[model samples]
Target: MSLVVRPSPAIWVDGEPATALPIPDRGLDFGDGLFETLLVRQGQPVLLDYHLQRLQHGIEALAFPDCLPRARDHLASACKQLIGTPWAALRLTVTRGAGPRGYAPPERVVPRTIITSAPLQQDRDELSAPITLGWAEVAWSIQPRLAGIKHLNRLEQVLAANEARALGVDEVVMLDARGLVCSVSAANLFLVEDGRLLTPSLEYVGIAGTRRRLVIEQLAPALNIEVVQRDVHAAQLEQAAELFCCNAIRGLQPVSRLGEQHWQDHPVCSALHAGYREAVAC
Candidate 1:
């Protein structure tokens, strides 16, 4: 697929076009919110159900009001505006509305939804291209309370991405404070060893990505690959036969280099890449 030039994103707040959010919005004040970045194809969100399911989990975990109906309505309206666009990136944000001057949330809560859409500047070939990774010096804090939800506080990722840019690598592998492999700066990490797929458990850190779930629950089973979720050590990557990172936006990206270790295009990675494309097409 060819990409379009970047354009100013269309913005909507609570189902209506808007320019700015209300002051004291908790999303901006305290990073108190959840957001989903999705791919839009021909005016419809790809893997919308998966995105909504994750969002629902976040809503429940955060104890926010029921926002799925409103979120769906807003998303439908936003998709209508992109009816002819071949590809676009959509971001849906849900916040606990504006709150008083402290961390303590009000007893009666109201949620706010913000949606934005912009032309997606992506080349199809780039998605499968192998890339290099560097180990980040910063480590993830183990916070089970915020482990798998895609909340708004992303300072850790920001710092790690900066480290990657300084190292001149595509991405950086992040480990938890306990010195166990977790994930990359912006995606989920996976390894292929002994003809089986291995991914780290997210009980203490890392976000459980929608694409990761798809791979474990559907794609890997279709290929008869045994999926294993357990604590992975940084040393394991050196012994793995293959390495790849995945997320909703980019799908699957194979890692070619990490320090002295390097990898070529492995068959397992290739099959999964092809399967991801087919899955998205449907």
Candidate 2:
């Protein structure tokens, strides 16, 4: 049997529930869109400003500058609609709206925005548990133009996620085409080495995750650790004292193994995780 995919349940669109975009939409045709996955706390988005900034930055990168108006108010209001859930995962998506055939967009553009919210599952608490990981045979593409934006083109991650499942690892550390460590399938990769926090630079590959940004600037200082951005390789993974992955929803998760490597809970990883939680909870 083959697997079937379904669109996410729509929560709001152009001020209507269950609304869907037209077929010729650019986002559907060419991945001409950007999105943010947010964690809702007590019906409010955490790190909301950062999420919007990233989304706006992504929009501008895609040549739709100022295509999105102030989205914070609309996003917060959408979250309020899910107040009964208390904790939810909200996905906000923006497409270059609709247009006629051909790569060239219409002289005028009208952007389409979609927001969906669902109750965050309890199993996500397992993120605190140190999980297994492995390297993916699939490598991320080096697209400098598209680098660092949470754009709609995610075929790489989808492949990486499948590789992780087939390899029976909780996550996969993806490499760039140059074999430099970029990120895990679903989140940003971080390793603690010699008392400093290190993660891959998103200069040429990978998305600049909102939580990763927070960790580099805010979480590291709170944990009293120096953070560095540079190319990391599998060889460097062996030198890491502790390992973790982070995202807006899971916040941060410790890694115990990547292939043959094994790690125990370290003070630095624990401290950083606590700091991450405090930052998100606040």
Clashing pairs in 2: none
Per-residue CA lDDT of model 2 for 64-168, tens digit only, reads 847556456667678877766657889988888888988887889888877887776543433477889988989999999989999999998999999999999
**RMSD in order of candidates:** 2.1, 3.7
Cα lDDT, all candidates: 0.89, 0.83
Global lDDT for candidate 2? 0.83
Q: Runs in model 2 with CA error above 4 Å?
A: 1-10, 123-127
Top-scoring candidate (TM-score): 1
lDDT by residue (tens digit), candidate 1, 51-76: 99988888988888898899989999
Global Cα lDDT for candidate 1 = 0.89
Task: Name the runs in model 1 displaced over 4 angstroms.
Answer: 1-5, 123-127
Q: What is the TM-score (0 to 1) of candidate 2?
A: 0.93
